[model samples]
Target chain A: MLSCTGYAARSASDPLAPFSFERRDTGPDDVRIEILYCGVCHSDIHQARNEWGNTLYPCVPGHEIVGRVSEVGTNVSRFRQGDVVGVGCMVDSCRECKSCRDGYEQYCEQGFVGTYNGEDRQGRGITLGGYSKSVVVDQAFVLKVPDGLDLAAVAPLLCAGITTYSPLRHWKVGPGQRVGIVGLGGLGHMGVKFARAFGAEVVLFTTSRGKIEDGLRLGAHEVVLSTDKEAMARETGRFDFILDAVSAQHDINSYLALLKRDGTLVQVGAPEDPLPVSVFSLLMKRRNFAGSLIGGIPETQEMLDFCGAHGITADVEMIAMDEIETAYARMLRSDVKYRFVIDMNTLAASA
Target chain B: MLSCTGYAARSASDPLAPFSFERRDTGPDDVRIEILYCGVCHSDIHQARNEWGNTLYPCVPGHEIVGRVSEVGTNVSRFRQGDVVGVGCMVDSCRECKSCRDGYEQYCEQGFVGTYNGEDRQGRGITLGGYSKSVVVDQAFVLKVPDGLDLAAVAPLLCAGITTYSPLRHWKVGPGQRVGIVGLGGLGHMGVKFARAFGAEVVLFTTSRGKIEDGLRLGAHEVVLSTDKEAMARETGRFDFILDAVSAQHDINSYLALLKRDGTLVQVGAPEDPLPVSVFSLLMKRRNFAGSLIGGIPETQEMLDFCGAHGITADVEMIAMDEIETAYARMLRSDVKYRFVIDMNTLAASA
Candidate 1:
């Protein structure tokens, strides 16, 4: 076992604080990463606070992981020492499952090994996540980060980027397509960027009128105040695709109506309470409501390469390791412009 | 105006009674059809009783129409004398809308004119449906019923056939795929037949084991009693697609669980109350809940052609025009084995 440092919530009701942990030693196909920056996702807050109720104790929750390859086992060929790398959402999965063979290991039927709060194949103990100093993972699950993109900002691209990217690609969001993005939060911001980069005419829908200027600057060609009935009526049955990134529980039917015949709306937000979806909303236009998790390994790499080629990076606020607690607090209030990335060098200096 | 004899509901709550009606003279693009047989649908019951709450007075409730061409206007070239034809759910739509132009006129932006209890472009009077001796419709809305299929048994194909076929076609049901058809009503039976005809391995899901034999006869490779937990559990996360055709409210999430990762369950049955779809069901497998109405004109023709080629037709119960009221009563009880097709020749003879 190797000693490591991270942040953990002692209990469900407790906030994250400094803690020490241990990671399994590198195996023959493992690559040990020194985590460079980890993006704080809304899911991290849900797990750290045990919002979904199954959260385990000493939960070191983070998944959007970007890092440096400090060491590699003898058999590892995908990465070597000093390589830039990333690990999003999962650390391991049964390689023999149908999902693993299909490149959708995120939905492994045998249960995937999560970056945090999930059991390994043997069901030994909970897996600690990327808020830690280092991790040992099978090389097959590690992604090579593109050389020139800012590693800190690129962290969110792994989770947020692919979460939005996968659906856009699956729905074929492309030229001459009018795409509507609901919300302008961390996920919505990425949706706009990707839709625009994919040659779509992007519209951002926000209830807050204040986000209008910011949404346009983030790559949206138009901003509609969702609260305005006139604006909504003007756009009804106009969109070819809608990416609903709003986490807050609201009327999904409103967005479903905005779609043209056979159009689709993909939800990436995992809201706790069940949303009431009107069947007529979908039947009316033969519309579809689907949910997509982060992309498969092949697609995630494709998204990163697309972002790199398009000169895209998340709008991230950098902070010292010690400021994480405050960053999480600000995150709950939607205080960050987009995302918060932790600078790993501050971890050693603070230690 | 042309006078016609038919049965209609005087009000939303009225039972079926004899009524004489009128249809406008054929326009340049119109074709006149002498009604032969009209299939009964669950929606006919919903509209006759105002179950969906918007049925107009003098509602002649029927859309799945089979008839012979009586005459064609000068500009109508698609059909001539002696052509056997059919009409499904709609009669007219704004032809210039994106949905109409894209071959999804069922979802026309300006709204397709419902075959019954709906108004026309001028909004002069409520349009009458095919529960009458004859109908006048735009040539674009008339479909050529192939010579091979039995006309009475093929009436339901206009509605139930295209309703099920559209979704199966959209989802790409084919060989090596496991498909599930929920419910054993009019739509479910058609769904099972269509899915099997598309070359998929078909499984019919019904609440009662009594439907086992009937399901296999209708082309199911197997039948699963949906109420049997052990049987359902044995097939969890296994289906590539599931068509849910139950009209009454039931647990939608139950059927959603049967879908494999990235699988879809399309709802053709409109339940009264909104279903509370669990986010976990969608999130875990990245699944989808989609809805489909009766198909567009082109697809309906394709479906009719496919059925003709496959020797497929609804297992129908024939009834005289006077038996329509009793048929409605039986439909309400789910007492009818399948569809009720009214013999228009009996109607004309009675007149």
Candidate 2:
């Protein structure tokens, strides 16, 4: 086993502090990477506090991990030493399932392994996340991080970026299509960039009026303050696709009212409260409400290449390893500009 | 204006009492139908009690209307005296709107006019429904009921029939498809029949095991008791489409979990309470929850023809016009076999 250190939450109420943990040594099919930076996802806070009721203790929660490869197992062909690689929400799956064969390993019939806190195949110990110094994962799940993009900004691409991008790609978002992206934080920001890159007329839906300029800067053709009824009324029954990234409970039906016939609204954010959807909203126009999780390795790599081609990456603020606690607090209040990326150089010094 | 006698709710709590309402003289585009039978719809109860908050006073709640044309306007070409016709939920719509032009007048962009308690284009007064002896409507919204199907049992074909049929047709249900009907009442019965008619393998999922025989009798290839975990597990991720027709809020996520990847569950019933959905379920399978309203006039005519050809009609119990209140109560308790059809002969004798 390889020894590593990461900021860990010992209890639900405990602040993250330096803690040592053990990761398995790289096996024949594994790659060991020094995690360069990790994107802070909203789920990190949710899991750390056991908000969704499935949290395991002593959690080191991070999934949007980007780093430089330090070592590769003898049979690992995907990466070599010093290769820039990324790991998203998943690490492994029972690869024989139909979903895994169909490039939807995230929906593996036997369940895909999560990057952190989820049980491993042997059901031995809880899986640790990417908040630490290094990680060893099977070669199948590792993605090549493209050269020249800001490494810190590219971290969230593993989670938030792919989470939004997967739905857009699955729905075939394209030219002349009107796309509505709900919310304006980490997931929503990527949604805007991806929708724009997909040649869509992107309209950003946000509750915060202050996000209008940022939304526009993120490549939205328009920003709708969702609270404005008149503005909403004007755009009723217009969108072809709506990527709803708002995790908090809100009026999902109101967004449904904005969709054209056969248009779909895909939700990636898991709300703590259940959304009350009016069946009439979907019935009247043949509208659809769907949800998507972070994508698999193949699609995640596709998202990265798409981003690399379009020069798309998250607008991020870099913080040191110890600042995750404060970053999490600010994240709760939606205070972060977009995403928070951990600078792992700070972690090495402290270690 | 002509005076028409019918049953109507003078107040929200009132029973169906004798009332007089006005009918516009046949315009060039008008067709006046003498209603022979009106199917009792669950929505009638909701509107009569103002449960959905859009009820108007002196409401005559019947949209599943099967009637005979008593008169036609000079320029009306679609119908003439003695033609059998029907009216579903919608009565009027702006013909120029995209939805109206696309033959989806039920989803008219300008908000399609309801058959009952909705304002007409001229804004003279709210339009009444076919619970009355006769209704005057624009020929565009009137559908010709096919011959050979029993008129009494075909009334529900105008509403419940088309509501289920539209989604089945839109979702491309066809031969060799595995379709699940989630309830066995008005809409689910129709869904099972239609899916079977479309040459699909129909499966009925019900909370009641007693419905198993009746389900197979209604064209279902098999019946699965939804409460049985082992039975549910045996069919996991298998259905290509699920038609959810239960109006009461329940575990929708459970039904969603039954769908195969990229499958859809269309809700035809309106539950007052919001259904609680887990994002993980939908994300895992790429499943979709959608809503579908009644079909357009063209499609309703097609459905009636389809039902007629298949010898399919609502399993209805005939009742006198005076028994509407008791019938509604029975309908709410699931005491009726499938539908209640008012005998207009009883209406004429009583009046």
Candidate 3:
């Protein structure tokens, strides 16, 4: 076993604090990563608080991971020592499932193993994620970070980037398309960038008027105040595809109506409650309502390559490892620019 | 205006009684059809009772129409007197909208006029349907009824038939695919027939075990009792497409579970309440929950042609013009197999 140090929530009601843990030794087909920067994702907060009621505490919650490869098992041919890499939401999936075979491991039939709060495949204890000193992952689940990109900003790309990228790619959103991004949060900001990079005419739908100038700067061609009934009504049946990144419950029907005939509205946000989708909204124009999870491994790598070419990186605020609890409070109010990435070197120096 | 006689509901509480109405004279681009047989639809019942809350009273409800052309204006080159023709749910639509220009008049931005209880496009009066002795329709709205198909049986093809066929066609359901048809009502029965005709393996889902033999008889390769949990559980992720034709409020998630990865469940049945779709259900397998309205004129024509080639027609019960009130009561109890067509000769004899 290898010793590790990270932040852990001792219980559902307890705040995350410093904790020591252990990880399985690097085995054949494994690459051990020295944790560098891990992005603060909304799901991390959910798991840390056991909001979904599935968390195993003392939970080490992080998946949007970017790090340096410090060691590789003998059979790990794709990666070696000192390589920059990433491990997103998933670490393992049943390779024999149809989704895995088709390169969509996120939708594995038996369920993909979450990077944190998940069972380790190699008989180790519960998997601790990238908020730690190091993580040993199967080479198949490891991603090579593209060179010349901001490594800290690249952290959110593992989860937020792939989450938004998969749906856009799956729906075939591209040039000459009018794409709408709902909610100007972490996911929405990335969605706007990707849609614009894909040569689509991007429109950001935000209830907060304050986000208008920021949205435009983030690559949206226009910003529509979604709260304005007159403005929303003016653009009825206007979007070719809408990427709804609002996690909080809102009327999805309003966005569903904005889609053109045969258009699709893909929800990357998993609200606590079921969305009351009006059947007439979809039937009216032959529109579609769908949801997407974090993408498969190959697609995640593809998204990274695309981001590298497009010079796209998440707008992020940097914080020391100890500030995660405060960051979580700020995240609850959506006060960060877009994302908060923890610099894990502070933990290493403290150790 | 041409005088016409049809049975209509004076108000929501009133049953159908003999009423006089008027239709526009045959204009240069119009064709007059003397009613022969009109298929009763579930929506006809909904409209008569103002179930949808959009019905105009004194509603003469019928849309699935089969008739003989009584007269054709000079510019009407498609049909002449004595030609067999049919009319479905729509009478007229704004010709300039993108939906209309693209041949999907049913989704016209300006709204397509319903066959009955709809404002007349020519300023004559509220448009009466084929329940009357005669109807004047735009030449473009008239479909040439193919020779050798039973006219009475073909009447339901205009509504239920096209309604089911459109989604199957739109979703590209074809050979070697597994298709599930929910419920054993008018739409589901047609769905089974169309899926079979399209060379797909059809599975009919019904709550009643008694429908098993009838389902197989209607071209379903197998029938799954939807109420049988063990049976339903055995078939999870078994279908590529499931056409939900059950208009009654039921758990749509159960059917959504039956679809394979990337499978779609299209709702053709318009239930009164919104279907509470679980987002995880769609996100898990990347499944789609969509709605499709009745097909466009061109696609409806294609469906008719396909039915004609495949020797497909609705299994209908013939009734006199006065039997509609009793038929409506029977329909509410799911006591019809599977459609009721009124014989216009009974109205002529009474006159």
Candidate 4:
């Protein structure tokens, strides 16, 4: 067993604090990563507070992981020590399932093992995630981070990036298409960058009027205040596709109304309560409402490479490990510019 | 002006009764039809009773029309006197819009003119539907009723048939796929027949156990009571596509869960209220929930042709025109076998 240091929440109401745990030693297919930077996902907060009603404490919650390979087992050939890599949302899956065979491990038939609070498929203890000094995962689940991108800013790509990118790519969003990003938070900001990079005419629909400038800076061609009924009405039947990154409760029908005939809106956000979807909205134009989880292993790697080529990285605020709770508070208030990435080097000093 | 006799609703609370009205004389691009059969749809009830809150009274609500051409204007080439023809939900649409230009007049940018209670585009008056003895429609909106099918049964094909057929065909439901049809009524019964005829393994899901036998008689390979928890649990992640034909309020999330990864659930029924859709259900398997309105004019013609080839038509219970009130009452309780087609010859006797 390998000794590990990380921050964990002891219970639903507890603030995350320093803790010690152990992970299995490297197996033949395993790669041990020295955690470097971890992006804070809204889901991390949901799991930490048991808001989703399924939390195992002391929960070490983080899935937007970027790290360096510290060790690799003898059989591992795809990665080497000191190689920058990533792990997002899943650590293991039943590779024999059709989804896994199709390279979509995120939709594994037997259920992909979540990066945190997931029972180990190998019968080891519950998995601890990237809010830690180290994580050992199967080489198949590890991702190669491309060169020339800021590592901290690349962390959110693991979760937020892939979540948006997969749907856009799957739906074939590109030139001559009008794409809408429904929020301007962690996921939405990345959605704007990717949609623009994909050569689409991008529009950012945010409730915040203050996000107009930031939205343009992030590559949105136009920013529409969603609260403005006339502005929203003007966009009706105009969008070819929309990526909704809002996890908070909001009217989804309004977005559905904006799609052109045979258009689609992919929801990557997991709002706690079900949204009331007007079937008429979808029926009127033969529109689609769908959801996409984090990308498959192959797609995630493709997203990373795309980001590297486009020089696209999430707008991130770097925070020390000790500042996680404060970051969470700010995140709840929608105060972060986009994402809050924890710099793991500060862990020891904070401890 | 052409004199017309039909059953009409004076107000939301009034039962449909015999009335007399006038229709525009046939124009250059028009095909005037002597109405033969008008299939009763659940929507006919909604419109006549103003359940959708858009009724224009003395409302004449019927769109599932199969008729004989009584007259044709000089510019009409598709039909001549005595030719069999049909009209579904739409009578006219802006031919220049992208939707109409694409042959999808049902999704016209300016909104297709409803057969009943819709303002006539030519500025005559409110367009009365197929409940009347005659209807004048543009050549573009008229469909050819193929030879060798019961004309009465074919009436419902204009609306219910196209409504179900469009989604199944659009989603590419075919051989070797497991397709589920929800609610075994006018729409569900046709969904089962079409899915079966298209060579899929058809499963009918109904809240009532009594419908199971009828589901099989209607060509379902399997019938599962949707209210049976154990039976529904056994179907999780098993369907390739599910056609939800239910218009009543029900838990949509449960059906969303039954889809395999990338599987779609298309709603053809227009429920009065919004359905609460869980994002998690859609996110988990990357499933799709979409709504398809009645098919495009081109597709509707194709559907009729396909039905002709397959000898498929709605299982209809023929009724006199005056029985429409009693039929609507029975329909609200879902007591009809499948559909009620009003025999137009009964109109004069009832009057």
Top-lDDT structure, candidate number? 4
Candidate 4 residue-wise lDDT, B224-343, digit = tens: 998899999999999999999988789999999999999999998878789999999999998999999998899999999999999999999999888888999999899998999999
Alpha-carbon deviation at B76 in model 4, angstroms: 1.9
Clash list (residue pairs), candidate 3: none
Per-candidate RMSD, Å: 4.4, 4.8, 4.3, 4.2
Q: Across residues A158-192, which tens digit of lDDT does each residue of candidate 4 receive?
A: 99899999999999999999999999999899899
Candidate 4 chain B least-lDDT 10 residues: B1-10
Tell how far residue A16 is off in model 1, in angstroms: 20
Stretches of model 2 off by over 4 angstroms after superposition: A1-23, A48-59, A122-126, A229-234, B1-21, B46-57, B226-236
- For each candidate in turn, the TM-score is 0.92, 0.88, 0.94, 0.94
| Model 4 lDDT, residue B53, Cα | 79
Candidate 4 local lDDT, residue A40: 96
In CAPRI terms, model 4 is classed as high
- Chain B TM-scores across candidates: 0.93, 0.93, 0.93, 0.94
Q: How well does candidate 1 score on lDDT at residue B119?
A: 62
Candidate 1 per-residue lDDT, tens place, A148-220, comes to 8989999999898888999899889999999999988889999999999999999999998889999999999
Give the alpha carbon lDDT tens digit for every residue of A167-217 in model 3. 999999999999999998889999999999889999999999899999999
| TM-score-based ranking | 3, 4, 1, 2
Q: TM-score for model 3?
A: 0.94
Give the distance in Å from residue A336's predicted Cα in candidate 2 to where it truly belongs. 2.4
* B-chain TM-score of model 2: 0.93
Best by DockQ: 4
Instruction: Give the CA lDDT, 0 to 100, for residue B84 in model 3.
Output: 92
